[model samples]
Target: SWELLQKKVFQNKSCLSELYDVSLEVAKRCKGLPLVVILVAGIIKKKMEESWWHEVKDAIYSYLGESEEYSRGTVHLSYDNLPDYLKPCLLYMGMFPEDHNISASNLINLWIAEGFVQDVESGRLEEAAEGYLMDLISSNVIMVSKGGRYNGKVKYSQVHDIVLHFCLERSREEKFMLAVKGNYSNFRLSDWKESRVSFSFSDGLSEIASKTRKPFHQHLRSLRMTLIKGEVSNWSAFRQFSKLRLLKVLNLSSHRVGRLSSAALQALIHLKYLAVSARKFNFHPESHLPHIETLIVLCPFSRTVLPPIFWKMKTLRHVEINDVVFDLKNNKKWISEESSKLENLRILKQVAIKIGADDNVDVLLRRCPNLQELEIGILCDEDSVEICQLESLTQLQILRLSIDSFQLNVSKLRLPLHIKKLVLRGTRIESIVSSIGGLPSLEYLQLVLPTFIQLKEWCLGDVTFHKLKLLKLECLNISRWDASEESFPLLERLVIKKGHELEEIPLSFADIQTLKQIKLVQCKNKSLKASALKIKEEAEAIGGSDIIDLIVKDKGFEDAKKIITALKGKGISATEAAGFCWG
Candidate 1:
């Protein structure tokens, strides 16, 4: 059914219809596999075209055959394809139950530190994790999607119930997948005819504090996470060990360690990625774990914000948050500030930051040199200030700004080479765009419409962006469309939405030779709907000589009266497109 709908409807529908159809298709495919659906959606969005439908359909068909053995929604084929090394890794996830949303970065680092994804070609754990998850998702193994509308990328990932059942079943053989899942209460020792097992529960810590006691797990390789909320005297999850060799990633991020005890530090001799989020995490840096690679301190601020100076744990790659009283507030604070400065992070320009008047943005940016994509959360509430000189960022390719009031010395903030995907939202920054240095490479540009904007003022006069393509806008209250300089050599999609004050579209863009699509939407306004009719007439008058795609952005039924008025002189259907949505 989805294949048929995609073939017959999706391509020719309005933006809303397209989204609706795609979403339905994705939901149906999930079959309780929410993680798989979300992951597939992201992979599909990377390259959108008619081929997208074909590829998605093909992938689904392939997935159906793989996990045929698993009950209902569980994917058996994908499970069968898991490599020997990765099987233990996937089963390890059983520690977390259904609806459990874990941060992808934190989980990946734990996996890497456990000698899971050691074959790092680019020398980046996050990058390698993204690739690994992409493959898993494409194969219909998991899901990924945004949890909320935070104007940024998705953070938490929820797992399916069926996926958990499979993981628990597989863990019986190796005795892995033990840290979480209600502190291993779900796994009864009688159920496991295994003596050489690990203990990771609250009772162990309770015993350790009451009496210098320790529950040893000689065969335990790693403690993925310890998710208790309050204070515990010993290790938040893992208590003791005897012959554990690969005790790599220890994430006690959200637990309270009353004091950084020497005994706890001594147990993790082979630790690599240690994400310890406690109230008083004042343990010996060097003597405790000399080979630790990534040490994270999660606070509650979330990933959208990065804090000030972090502890210089020499072997650490990521850290975040500030736990002054020993309680971890913001999870993002655990990510080390030092990771951004590493020379290898030049390729990681997709930085998400909230820069305010109090923030020293200039100092913060100095750490990130090869920034390609910058998603800024700016709040210019008091004491309006100018942001850092963008010219220093020689490699910024994409810029998405959410500014309350962005005061930039535009003169000195030069556009980096090959800039693409520029998005400006919720701002009244009336400034001149004199020279956008890399105009050619820009493909997608989104501008949040204000009540009034000087259209001509932002023009790069008589300039043709040969490479400029898709441009989108939402709830932008502009007066008219300015195609007066619409010389986009290959413009494909132009989308404008939810404008209350839009009277007309720029007459200049009607005869765009290469234009393939134009989309418009009206929200809560009758006057704007009438203007849309008028604009359609004006646009048709110009469209008479071109094969451009005409989109009508309007609300309410433009019945007999509206049609008569629109076609009074310009005889064209304001409601229909001959082979498309011209009706």
Candidate 2:
């Protein structure tokens, strides 16, 4: 009660943050001053009532005693007497929306635009905004999620949930929204049956898809049906949809959809993102869906053939599938005009296969002049010249190769010179660095053993790559690291495998200046501590903490604590982290 009275008195007196609950404007009067917090909380509790708050504010007018100015309590008075006008300048923080993430740059620009900054001070607006935001934060009117400010502009600030709740209670008295729980029902709005509807069927099953025929007559622009238990709602089994303009985004994943029939898919000209799988059926080409940008058809080893008409989807940006077998053995087949028209394709993202048939995949790949990312499966069972030539994919950004263990000459796989991210699975690393030196823009590279294969000898000891930023090696049983890359100047994250046999940490990592994170799993190498220590020493010299996060999986809390203490004893801080397990 005393604190609340003081808050009222401060407001009436035009004081600084001496009140219990500090106002947003006055809290930043000091640099995270601790006194502001206790006083603000204390005063707020006493003035929790609405009438009291009004009286507190109204007293400002009465307390001035005929003068135009009055005390703003302790918070404002301290603010008014600041070395610079920024005390009040910082308190007027209404430019940013409540709960909005205010960027340091953004705050500086706003302050500059408002002409509230003195030009002589270096980082003038940013420094002032920083002091202001910090004051508000320390006083509990705001919070700082990100510890540091970006671009040296403004201090990060967030409102508390309780404060937001108070505002919400007052502001949302007339506006409120409540979400109804449970799966979408077959019982839909009868008035808009012809219109497209977004439906969720993750819980077991719902008869909505099956019955879209009976009561549905609207043109569906999109239909996303995912997380269902079984096959796609056998709507085709009942009746063919009128015109697929009736659908756009059709996602029937984790379900058993035999096929997207040719006739049923004819009129879907406006389709964009389609995620469906025919585990035991084939894709029948019907019409071209020009609007489709993302297509995913994950299928196991089966007879589900891709429709030849898929060549007409010129705007395709993403393709994610487990496996694909292109059979071009028909000697009497003919190529249509659409087969040569692949110029608009920008992405053919991911592909997996057990066997690749003898088809002109070269001619097929040549059509997408803007291809950016590709994941090819080396499933050349009977075919030798599988991936012929992809020199045309100049815009290729990411390439992943998931190959079977038996396939040899893994080095034959090639990529565009400016690729960004490359991942290799079930492949040997003979001249990994040299062979990959052609990639000028490569930022990330991941090499993992798919099926318990030991990494015998990867002469990565003699090559140099100037642009590799991230290197991830997992699940490969190796005893040593003979890597000799010219200090990956921008490498950031290094993740070692869990439950793998590794004798020591890579000594090559000792010189990388930009290295930021290193995660160790089940395998703790003999040099792990030394490597961590070196990183700590380097980070501190560079004015930052290298050991930001440490996760010790499959270790007891006590043992984890011991390991952490040992590291901290070595001057490298460590913490035990927990992962969320969803049932």
Candidate 3:
């Protein structure tokens, strides 16, 4: 509690030495309850006055008098103290299921769709929503469940049971949203007057459709049906949603459902956010959703062909479709049109662009010039279609390129200067690793090459990855790696997967002060494992303790036990000796 208070409130400010006693007293008043301590700290962090601290201490003391309801009182006080703008955001958390780890991106998008996040000085709603999330996180109202593997940014977040309960109660009081869990039979349609409604039950849509013969809620703006189990076989049930003319947000992407008919969505002219899963998707956004800002189509069964009108949606900010093909051949005239530019588009993922002789991806990329994250697969076998125009996308930060059966000649590839994360699959980069290393803003680089075409030798002779933090090499045949600490001065994590032919990691990596974790997966080389162990030993010898983590994984469970036993014979603890496997 004291540490958290110091970090969040004091921020290691030595000038606040006089408040140490008062802060300790305040922390002690919470009785070691983490949430209460965090709430108290968040309340007092705004003011540095000694009198204010004392007042906060007394206020917490008053809550402590109610021993049975102390936690609830403290939480309620915190909620009451929240700023008006943030109250709705907090209450919105109840819309998700209990114990559900919500995606930060999805939550922010929802907040944006719900008009909870107001415009900030930067004019980006996403940034403002992120600030709100961080504020809640700092206050301990929200918990960071998981972070991104490469960037370490919060990917998943969840609220505690107490907080969730509080949010649900407050939401009910405010009539903000209705969350339907378990059977839909208990749900009363007349009682649901809230603008937003979320269903966490099976066959929720069918039940509601069958119950309501007419348009039930014309005032409803958002509706989400999260199927926990079983697929919705009745595709016709979706036609019932057409009555919701004012619906702004609709999500039914949890389970496999039938193709959403255009007629069902034709009446949803006010829809801004749409997420649906289907075997085949033929919904035309240009004709149907004129105001759609976020569109997500999940088709895991087969590749869905996106219509040419997909590129013409001007209001789209985020587009994510899995296993989808874009037939840009017929869309050439549409691309050449001056008004086809998607200036608001920020994210485009898992989109396979079919490049032919007459059309190139450059023409398409020129339309969406402001894309921040792009994951595209070049579906072409000809060598003429090369990714040479990515440098024009100066705003791009994350890029994943997959060129199937095509060698990505790095010499010809001109990457964006500001890209922070780059993942290349089915591409050859053995000859020109220096070109990629020269990226000034790159922090994470993952190379997952095909088995038949392996990177033989990667020698970092004179090049330096100045800002690189994580380097992942998978399915590579490189046997010799000539690198020093100078090569990757800021690298923290090293991951090698299926590197069967690689001899060992360079001993010089042990000397890199910033190195923290070295993970080897299915790499049968005993010498490579020994090299990682030696790095740990050397790091401990120099740094005075075990500062580095070594995780090794093979294919066999028994071999992992044997390796753990062997490591235990050494000074390694059981926790540190885990995660080893053998092929």
Q: lDDT winner among the candidates?
A: 3
**Where does the lowest 10-residue lDDT sum fall in candidate 1?**
323-332
lDDT of 2 by residue, 424-509 (tens): 87766653456776677877777777332235434454456667766777776566555632546667667676525565455556
Error of 1 at 552 (Å): 12
User: Model 1 over residues 100-211: C-alpha lDDT tens digits?
Assistant: 7767666676666666676666556666775665555444455564432212334556556666677766676655554333454465433433322334444443332243
Candidate 3 residue runs with Cα over 4 Å from true position = 1-8, 11-15, 62-68, 121-123, 149-152, 213-215, 229-236, 261-263, 383-385, 407-410, 450-455, 555-583
Name the best candidate (by TM-score).
3
- Candidate 2 is scored at a TM of 0.59
| Full-model lDDT for every candidate | 0.50, 0.50, 0.79
TM-score of 3: 0.90
- Per-residue lDDT, model 3, residue 231, is 49
| lDDT for position 345 in model 3 | 88
Which residue pairs show backbone clashes in model 3?
Answer: 554-581, 554-582, 555-582
- The CA lDDT at 532 in model 1 is 41
The TM-score that candidate 1 achieves is 0.55
Poorest stretch of ten by lDDT in candidate 2: 574-583
